[model samples]
Target: MEYFVHFLLAILLTALSYFVGSRIISDGVAIWQALIIGLSVVSLGALTEALGAPIWFIVLVPFPVGMLLLFLFLHEPLYTWFFTYLITLALYSVFHVIMSYFFSFHSLIPAWRLS
Candidate 1:
């Protein structure tokens, strides 16, 4: 049950980050495309985690995949891609902190505990 809750929270945060990031960046990446990129990042992260990767590796895995997916799907230019990725990361971190501190949510990344 706790796992399910964390899973749902992770999904929600991932999607929300991309949605908000795209809107903030105004990179013209559609909402649906943003959603796909977000979900893909989460899915890839989860897969690496499930494969028994190290904590650091699991944490690091999603970034490149996300940037690649962003470029491949949205064709965003270099600066936009970097800025969008930065925004996504920043938003996710902020949301994660809020959820963890205020709502007692689990870490979005494995082997991490904010509580």
Candidate 2:
């Protein structure tokens, strides 16, 4: 059940990322392209986690995926994609760190603790 939930969550997160990325890019980006990029990012994250890297490292996976997609589809310059990728990575890393910290903290609280 737990694994199923995680799988579902991964799917949802990937979809959400794709939606947001596509919307932001907005100039002829196809849904399938977005989905592919999103899935790649999520797969990288999963692989990193499986390899026993810290959660923070998993958060960095999206940037390269996004950059690759942008360079491939948007005709964007590689340097532009690289810069945006770094910014996206930093933003995601902060978000992941904050969410993980709060989640772990809440889990430690007696009311939220699972045995």
Candidate 3:
């Protein structure tokens, strides 16, 4: 359904983030590898979401795991973790802005918070 569409879009954007981050900062992280890592992280997020986790948990928890994954997978330095996360957020926001123009469904606009 709609959620599935959003999920796929999110994974795609995640891949885009990895591509951007690798190119701009971590020169060693390949596009192919980025696609794999991005897909894996988003998949983990989706799994956690299905377990009744909160929005913050869904948005935030996978970050450290992602950082670890980058280190392990790309042999990237700890410093590049910042750029990786930063690029993900930036690119995700860009994706949201564009999608918002076409669809009323605003996934990036925080909904149903714990508080």
Candidate 4:
């Protein structure tokens, strides 16, 4: 159940971040594109967690996958896609902090698991 909530939140966050990032880069991301990126991120994160990956690994592994997804899905130029990826990550970190501290939840990006 917790993982389910986290997955849902991650999808929404990713979509919102895509919107904001697109605006920042003066590029555009379709709604479906944003959702696809979000799904890719969360799915990869969940897979890493299930594999007993270390916290650092879990957090770091998803970055490239997401960036690639952005390029593949949006077909944006380097500057636009790269910056959008960076901005999305930045916002994800902020939301992760909020969710972790305020909500007392596990990390949003899928790190260590509870026993």
Find the candidate with the highest lDDT and give its number: 1
User: Which model scores highest in TM-score?
Assistant: 1
Question: Per-residue alpha-carbon lDDT of model 3 for 8-91, expressed as tens digits?
Answer: 776777777667766776565776777777777777788777887987887776677767666776666666766666776677
Summarize candidate 2's per-residue lDDT along 24-73 as a digit string, tens digits: 53443466765666567666766776788765566665556666775686
Q: 70, model 2: CA deviation in Å?
A: 3.3
Model 1 clash pairs?
A: none
* Candidate-wise lDDT, in order: 0.76, 0.52, 0.67, 0.74
- Give the Å shift of residue 112 in candidate 2: 17
Off by over 4 Å in 4: 110-115
Worst 10 residues of 2 by lDDT: 105-114
lDDT of 3: 0.67
TM-score of 3: 0.71
- Per-residue lDDT of model 1, residues 3-113, tens digit only: 667766687788778778767876556777777877788788888888999989988988887778766765667888778778888998888788877777755755556
Candidate 3 — which pairs collide?
none
TM-score per candidate: 0.83, 0.54, 0.71, 0.81
Residue 91 of model 2, lDDT score: 47
For residue 104, model 3's alpha carbon misses the true position, in angstroms, by 4.4
- In angstroms, the error of model 3 at 51 is 1.0
